[model samples]
Target: MRSLMCLLFLVIFCSVQMTSSANLAIEVANSNCCGVFSNKKIPVNKVVSYYKTSSICARRAIVFKTIAGREFCINPETSWVRSHVDIVDKRTATPP
Candidate 1:
């Protein structure tokens, strides 16, 4: 009985430690995951509809959305996308 209890306790303790460690890694990764998909992949044999000819962002999102559904490409690369909004300012582009 004592051995069983000890085993259970150890398992619970290890699980807790693993979860906390995993959560920390998730937080760190998320902080840096935004806007990481800018590098384009050649999307041939796929039909992507563009929202507008003028806006590149809309077009890129359409391409992703068409393939993966509405929310697949949340933050895309701005430079690869043609933006009508002056979307990327020089200030934001330049490092402080």
Candidate 2:
């Protein structure tokens, strides 16, 4: 019984750690930029089209991952990113 309790505790702790790590990564990605930029732009719906923590320090940027597994920092102020964000927001918003 004691061993089983220890195992359960370990599992819970690991799960919490993983969740926090992912959250931290997202926060960092939203606030930072990547070290390099990709030559091609990825659509927002792509599989790799998600924000991630930038591996490098950049100013006013968020790391973007393309469907092709490429990573780069893009300026959120750009019309492209802004427009996509709007679209996503609209799609995800609760319907009246």
- The most accurate candidate by TM-score is 2
lDDT of 2 by residue, 1-96 (tens): 999999999999999999989987777766545555555555777624445444445455656655578666666666687766566567567899
Off by over 4 Å in 2: 1-33, 47-57, 65-71
Q: For candidate 1, write residues 3-64 as lDDT tens digits.
A: 99999999999999999899777765544232334344324223233232223122434223
Question: What are the runs in model 1 whose C-alpha is more than 4 Å off?
Answer: 33-96
TM-score, predicted candidate 1 vs. hidden true structure: 0.33
Name every residue pair that clashes in candidate 1. Answer: 56-82
Candidate 2: which pairs clash?
Answer: none
